[model samples]
Target: MSTARILIKHGDVRYRLLKVEAASDGSLICLLDKDPQPLKGGIRVETGKLIAEADLEKPVPYGRFSIHTTGEIHRYSGGQRKDTIHIEPLHQLTKAHAVGYFSIPTPERLDTYDASKHTADVVETLEIPTEVSERLTFLLEIGPKALKVATYGIGLSYELYTLVSRSAAARLPEELAASFVEAAALTVFDSRQIQKDEAELRFYQKIYGQGSFVFRENGGAYVALTSVPMARAPTMRVEFDGSELSIETIPFDAQNKPTHKVRFWIRDKGGRNKQHDLREHIRSVVFDARL
Candidate 1:
């Protein structure tokens, strides 16, 4: 029930809605709406060896820009041959669905534009910067059940390259032309996917902060001190059995730094007290007279 519009423009050259048809694959087909006649041959671009004679200087008019509908090819008159343009069916149009370009050749001051004039409720027309211009082409993609929008760019590069290369390949069967064209187009899509994956991974890394810690806890209390500034470590605590005057020895080096040999003293003198270092280890420093 939803519909999308495709606009094509190149400088002063502009083409509006031409034709629309229901595709066999459940998607909609569109082209220059003027032409309703059957084409003599397949529609193609004017920038190839077949049209341009491989001559760089010749004007390769836009004849190949065609529309395929109703099992016929409808080509566009490059305006050089014909004043108006027509689109036919059965052109097997690819990457011909969505495209537009904007350019402004005059100074911003000369082009009277007001942001207040912009409104989604209506189709707003604004002049583009004269300094820039571009040509864009797109395709209508239908999934297993629905239609989707796709664009044409680098993929077209490989398509053009393959079309030109295979056309020039010596003694190549014409029947295989379709296969070469597909392969060339696919290679471009694959390369784009790889580049896209890399970009996505980079974005994910930024969102998910790094650095993780994994360790096990013992029954008794344990504490870990990290030398790294501002880093927090884990601490474990184990309670004494029954306020027993039990003592654990903790040894230390001459510099007073506790080593693994260091023992800790735990005495129930009202509350538990732990002193680390063998020198400070709980010993009978003052023998009890009763003992």
Candidate 2:
């Protein structure tokens, strides 16, 4: 049986797990280490109602869903609590999971981080410069917090919004909040140390369900890029000089999901580029990508 230890902390925050074990059967358990009982494992910061990411692979008719995680249990759907599109997709990738910010332990990400320090603090202690750290911190923490505030409405989640909002505006920077609302977001997870260019595909999720992408860059944990949604405008907009591409599409299926596609291309003499080169370009821009 294989065993691992996970340390979790954030600037003297409430939780710091000295040992979080991942059992062989995929069931997780808090181990005999660090802090005290009620250490709070499910502290998820849902910025707002989840606009389900479209699972085009298994598109369900509107007003109905069969969630795969829960034994394919079919559940009725309703109109969105917020003014955003409610597409039915599976899973969301937030900094909370990437950095273990009050989330259940997942062995894959934790094993790659510093085994002796909290995931968040290890990110902080990387000495990656204050401005960059602040940007990353906001991306993983306050930025997501702000997104929740922008799309809140009075429904079953009214109390939740009120509770999170009490400290949302006071604690978040106005500019970062505004940026998240007005753009498509990209999160790049670097895995060079593990000897791979693309570690895994993170489901790119955003408020409006605009397309998102993830890949690794050097010298950082991850990077994000956000752009305004233009699902059917037919404009060929490009960012990151030329490594990244996003364009509107005149397409719709049964669920009215935006059929936009993102393409990554790097310039070359043969009008083609290798995947490694593309990874390098994005990594070089991680610390300086437009948010």
Candidate 3:
């Protein structure tokens, strides 16, 4: 028994092994096995080409066409083997389902096979939305783990800070408002830096105080509290160089100089670990009820 294969060109090119039921007068009808019900359609000769599956090693010659073992359909002219038909395989087909037809590429000899070049062609033919397709391609290449970390871990932290900042701007204590906003912004920045190093899911905690608010790092494992005078809020400056954590508080006085500066060095096994610790400490003081 011979298997039936159909070569189709309908805007997009597709070569698939379909169960062909009948072929006559340049028109063919096939029964789709994958569909729940049989699909019947008249495929004109101009739109499709049908070939019977046979022993590839034994070339089958029918009139002017010959199916060779190399999976090439060769044309005979004046009893001489003429041109070899070249079939391009669909690329990026796995990213999306082939709408009208099942996406399957015919086997070709190693020397003549190159599917990498047709990636753009396949993506264009699918007519998928550009943004959606790009995101899908990125997700496919980067894997789900990285996507989850980006969406949930880093992305969530940013959202939380934005929400807190907005709320703090309206209801936070007047003296601690500046400290709260600054801490929130710095926490968001540091969260992005150390999110990759963090192995477990930990959220920021809020601690309220009279003239200050503490953003507890990674659930209170590390703490850096930002404090100002009860009379007024001072400008706060924070710097972390992977090993040392520094915070300088400058009051709005006549000299306008830093009134208090505190620094802590976090020595660890590696620079990355030290940076991670410092980032956590900075992050811990970003959220508080007073803000």
TM-score of each: 0.20, 0.20, 0.15
**Tens digit of lDDT per residue, candidate 3, span 140-203?**
0111111232221111111111100011112223332221011100011111222210101111
Residues 66-116, candidate 2: write the lDDT tens digits.
112101112222212211111112123122211111112221112233335
lDDT of 3 at 73: 30
Over all chains combined, what TM-score does candidate 3 have?
A: 0.15
lDDT of 1 at 189: 20
Please identify model 1 stretches exceeding 4 Å from their true place: 1-5, 8-18, 23-28, 33-48, 52-132, 145-291
* Cα misplacement distance, residue 230 of candidate 2 (Å): 3.1
* Preferred candidate (lDDT higher): 2 or 3: 2
**Distance (Å) between predicted and true CA of 226, model 1?**
78
- In angstroms, how far off is 22's CA in candidate 1? 2.4
* Positional deviation of residue 187's Cα in model 1 after best superposition, in angstroms: 14
